[model samples]
Target: MAGHPLKKIQCESIARTSGKQCRAKGYLKKSGHYRCRFHGGASTGAITLEGKLIAYKNLKQFKNYTDEQLLIWIQNKLQKSSSV
Candidate 1:
């Protein structure tokens, strides 16, 4: 039997102790995750409004847009939703 080829991605987080990126290669377990175990692999979702906005802006399905464009999009959407 043939063995499966391993897949890995470099972690996208910076290390606190080293003041540099962790960059450890790891297998992805879920959508849009790129960090290894020691570099925030297990967690999902952003806690703050700013974090949420940033995460939303980076989603793959979203059109490539400037941060200002995304922020404006979010505000318009939220305003419409809240008023309805």
Candidate 2:
């Protein structure tokens, strides 16, 4: 896949409804389809540390941001979520 480097880390979860394990892998804008490492080749959807769905375009815009910054952003989004 393109020249962009793959993300070092990834997050995984199981869909309660479908029972299908879902994994999110970070990829470059050139990556055609957004998918987990196992099933599909690449991914298009960007997922935050806290599991928020950020637009793929936005991900490209902030691709230069440090991992710490991205983690903080994800934490902030998680903070806004309703307590379970």
Query: Highest lDDT: which candidate?
Result: 1
lDDT of 1 by residue, 1-80 (tens): 23432544567777898988775775466666676877554766676668868889778866688778777877897789
Look at candidate 2 and tell me the lDDT of residue 65: 69
Per-candidate TM-scores read 0.39, 0.30
Candidate lDDT values, in order: 0.72, 0.52
Worst 10 contiguous positions by lDDT, candidate 2? 48-57
In candidate 1 the C-alpha lDDT for residue 63 amounts to 60
| Candidate 2 clashes between residue pairs 3 or more apart in a chain or in different chains | 34-43, 34-44, 35-42, 35-43
Top candidate by TM-score: 1
